[model samples]
Target: MNDIAKHPLAMDGKDPSNLRGDPIDPERYYSRSFMEKEWQQLWTRIWHIAGREQQLAEPGDFIVHDFMKESVIVVKQTDGSLKGFYNVCIHRSQRLVWQDNSQKSFACPYHGWVWGLDGVLEDCPDRGDFPQGDPVGKLKLSKVRVQTWGGMVWYTMDDEGPDLLTYLAPTAELYKNHQFERTVRVNWLRVALNTNWKFWSDNFNESYHTRTVHPQVPPIIDQDHFTSRYEMFPMGHNRIIQMGRPSLRDRLPDGVPHPFDDALRAWDIDPDSYPDFETKAMQGWLDLKAAKKKLWKEKGFLHYEHLDDEELTESPFQVLFPNVAIAPGADSFLVWRWEPHPTDPEKCYFDQWTMAYPIEGQAEFVNRTAVNPLRLVEAELDFREYDNGAGVQEYSDQVVFQDWQLTAGQTAGWRSRGYRDPYFAAQETRVRRFHEVLNDYIAGNPPGR
Candidate 1:
């Protein structure tokens, strides 16, 4: 791994001594009161991703991001800037937009109030009937702080919260090489799961379960704890950088085709030339980096020009505080965001977006987490209920599908009388740290606030 020590904000996420050893209470995962506290203290104060900036390329394009009971609309302005407003009509409390699309102006369906692209009220019915004077030019949609970063549109409900870049901290600086704006979201999917949203935050904080739940990952991305580097930030986010090669601990049975072999051959390295499994896993990884460095431009992988050696062949999975995780690799970027359901504490929505750089001739991109091949274009939203694994049967091969299968059992375990404080592995230190941060937020002491 590169010298993370050079990054002043990076701390050893695997060290238990860095954490407060807070007991992860079971109630926080399933209790309505605890969920309400999170809604008031944590969710409202934090920045949220509305959608990709690519979705609002034109002046009047907009995207609606509904979180729990609140909804926000981020629109592209005529001045080539982005603006966000609470998705509610000024006259009445009706929602302004039902979905994401382009429009010349926002027309409230219940009333004839028309809000301009700039959010000012352009026209309204019964102009002379208002006792408080006409609301046409005087009334405007309530605004939220909007900003764009990494090709994403973000807004925060708390007017006093830290700015988007500051809240993200070193993470924003860490991934500066990635041209996220250049990639297209090939797969945009949201699945309703029968579990609390924190399940994803906990699941993504550690790779200890990958060996048991996602057996195929070790062959493609080394999951062995000793071979990986873990770093935690003071701002509550954490990341794990794993080797992008087959793990010596997880060797396939003799004569079975290795996925790493295909990766090596694609980069013009001969896997058979390594003479041994250990050599192929270690030295072959180094050779693959060299091959990419030498062949990237010729292969039309222009996006790799700014990538360093580590970014070229390693996988760094980042958990952005409470509920976002992203694996930004050389060829593809996989992002996951989990949001709490409006009323039910046990139900949550999980969004998965698979984005890929547009290589010259590649017509399709297959994300590492799933086998489904997606066309290389911006995809429309596809939403479904997990329905105990029946609604999303087409995505059964996905790693997230396997995780979703465990949600019900885990949810039950959390409520069990036998359940207590988690006996966490050293590698799972980030998991407990996440709870500590949540505790801080509920206690009115959120980090970076």
Candidate 2:
């Protein structure tokens, strides 16, 4: 691995200078050709997290992923095995599935062609007259490599990319600490953006903007006494660890649960409507030290709290390159999925799966030991209105809007004569590392520093 400390932009004790210039023109990220090349060279050749294994909680349960330019379905067979295949009908190349729930077989909406959960041709209209000698024996949905980790289901466009663990090797140890298989509630969105996918990937890689750009989201928690750390994986994967906010139980009146404590916090309160107090006075401020001390003792945070200053300054912020972010915390975990736009490199879909796992003995979970992942069959959002006058998921929407406004704006500027090479932040080492690894990938050179 190239020593992170010696990289051209890595600076010790001071912010790196190489990264302090104008942000890269978002235009390059919006270019159609640039996106097309990235899709072929990077996305298609790597393992991408498809969905959660729990989604296929039972036999026949399945979810379809519109990956890159291809449609895929990951299904759980009756034998308790997992399988994936192109979501297209073998007959006329039409899509075979639309809904993400379970079915005995997938029947194409265009025609009545049906496929078994195992991707076998279970039924074909007028098959008795065909000379193809029973399409059942000759037709099977084209399959892809499917695997599980931390309870997340992943698939690759390539039949030959490294297995899930191998691709995640650089940060496997840290990821194992996540215990994803034990997680509870998970809700995801399929977001489409009008820019390159990397724009979203790099945005989540750092926290320097939390206090400014995302004041509402960051202010609810303690920002001090934490770390901001990152690890880059070959093949454009990156992980970010942002420190967690201190407990806010004391901020609430006695017997009232902290609003943010609920896994369904977003369902009740929109984060955008909340007040933005500085971290110091945000919650239980007068007695933060005492509150944290008592909360730590009761919650056992003191035990999991790392002694290393770096770990202390940061919480776990991990990004699976190309498109996926697993950001877990003691209170809740956020899983984001970035899907590509079918025709617009300047646009792609984005989804957020906000999950909260019950502590070992929380009464809400009657079967704490049994793997009973909560299912969210409905969302409370008014999608027709971006924020509906609030911004949590919409905050994410706003961020994407900000990105889109700029990327689209920059596309106009890419043609301007005054546009120049971009600069990055010293703290924004993740961005530099991104391009470094990206350049290597583009040149067919080895990944990792």
Q: What are the models' TM-scores?
A: 0.97, 0.70
Please write out the lDDT profile of model 1 over residues 92-168, one tens digit for every residue. Answer: 78898988999999999998899998899999988999999999988999999999888889999889988998998
| Residue range 32-92, candidate 2, lDDT tens digits | 7867767667777777776777778799899887766787899999999999998888788
TM-score of 1: 0.97
Query: Which parts of model 2 are misplaced by more than 4 Å?
Result: 1-27, 109-112, 125-132, 216-227, 240-314, 360-417, 443-449
The whole-model C-alpha lDDT of candidate 2 against the native structure comes to 0.57
Worst 10 residues of 1 by lDDT: 1-10
Q: What is the C-alpha local distance difference test score of candidate 1?
A: 0.91
TM-score of 2: 0.70
The 10 consecutive residues of candidate 2 with the worst lDDT sum are 1-10
